[model samples]
Target: MKISYLLILLSLTLGTPSQIDVSEVRTAYIKASGDEQAVEQLNSKLISVTTTDDKVLVAYKGAVGTMMAKYAKGLKDKKSLFKEGVSLLDYAVTSDSLNVEIRCIRLSVQENAPKITGYKKNIDDDKAFILKNYNSMTDEGAKKFVKGYALRSKVFNDNERQLFQGL
Candidate 1:
């Protein structure tokens, strides 16, 4: 009985040696879209994951960059932030071209950005890709995040929402 109890306790503590999970990290990031406080929290998390994969880091930075771009106070500040964010975003996507979650982040940013910014090119393709492979995602939180997004945003049409059914 003592040995069984010890084993269970060890799993609770050491089973999750890595502090961050990709799905959780990605979800926290998307939730931080316009909130400055959330963005700051995200930056803190991003910094602590030095040993994490480059793709995940890139995606987190891209999300943080977008938030900074949207909230930076001055025109010059905003422009600079936009440059940084877009650079990170491109780098992340290039590094992991087939990552559906990263593409979802880009889609969310572009769909809501001002029309004059010319960042709306991939909405259709991303929607198609996300829908095509969404069911295969192993992370339940990630699935819920995408489904929540599709339900709340103007990015998807009625027909598209139907496709995202039971997500």
Candidate 2:
């Protein structure tokens, strides 16, 4: 009886899924743009997950999926990955339209997506939304992460970038 109980307890512990950290995801996202390893790491972490209930995680999952397209070998695979990533991202946005971080993630993807993908439609709207909502955000970590991305983004011109510089 004792052995069976111990085995069951061990199995239950091992079967529980780990919680993903948003801050860690944010850090990985920043590195993912320039690092293929970061992208791969994020992909592996988020690929099999199937729910968008956690909006931030789903958004990062989408962003990482989109970024993975650049590393894909074949054109078809590239398009498939990009499409899947964008689909997840869109779902996240629809689920939580007012989440600034989600909008920021979408903007990042849209701004960098190729014109051929036709995924650039939301750039202006997302950028405007982010700018308008940024200062009002209460999560300092999120604000800092978004500001860091904005500083390096091509869509945010000199004057626009300045808004994120001081604070």
Candidate 3:
């Protein structure tokens, strides 16, 4: 009985998924742009996320994957990582089309993605979506996250940035 209980306890501990804090992910994401270590750490934390997990978490997983591509040494590995990330991001968007946070995440990725990657197609659409729906977001944290990103996004012109002011 002791051995069986120990086995069960070990299995339970090993099988449990790590808990993701969305706020921490958001904060890490902001740091990732300038810090490769932050990107690697966030990617490691999010690597276990699957399609069945929360859509927002899936989106972060995708975002970190894309960021990881920047640190990849080989061109093939970089392209592969980017494509996989974009695929996951697209899946999350499809899963929750109306989620403004997801849209913001995609916009951040697309805006910064190289033009040669052909992943820039959604920039205009996502920008428009974010602009139109940003005010409707009920979560203060979500609003702050979006506003923080928009304030720094190159895609948002001076006039557009004004919309997110005083948030």
Worst 10 residues of 1 by lDDT: 47-56
Where model 2 places Cα greater than 4 Å from the true spot, the runs are 1-18
1-167 per-residue lDDT for model 3 (tens digits): 99999998875554423567788888888888968999998887777689999898899889889989999999999999999999999999999989999999999999889888989888889999999999999978778999999999999999999999965
Clashing pairs in 2: none
Better model by lDDT, 1 or 2?
A: 2
Best by lDDT: 3
Pairs clashing within candidate 3: none
Please provide TM-scores, in order, for all candidate models, with all chains considered together.
0.76, 0.87, 0.89
Lowest lDDT block of 10, candidate 3: 10-19
What's model 1's lDDT at 101? Answer: 73
For model 1 the local lDDT of residue 135 reads 80
lDDT of each: 0.72, 0.86, 0.89
**1-167: candidate 1 lDDT, tens digit per residue:** 99999988965654332555677676777678678888877766665333235665666666677677777899899878777776777777777778777777777877876776687888888888888888888767667777777777787888878877855
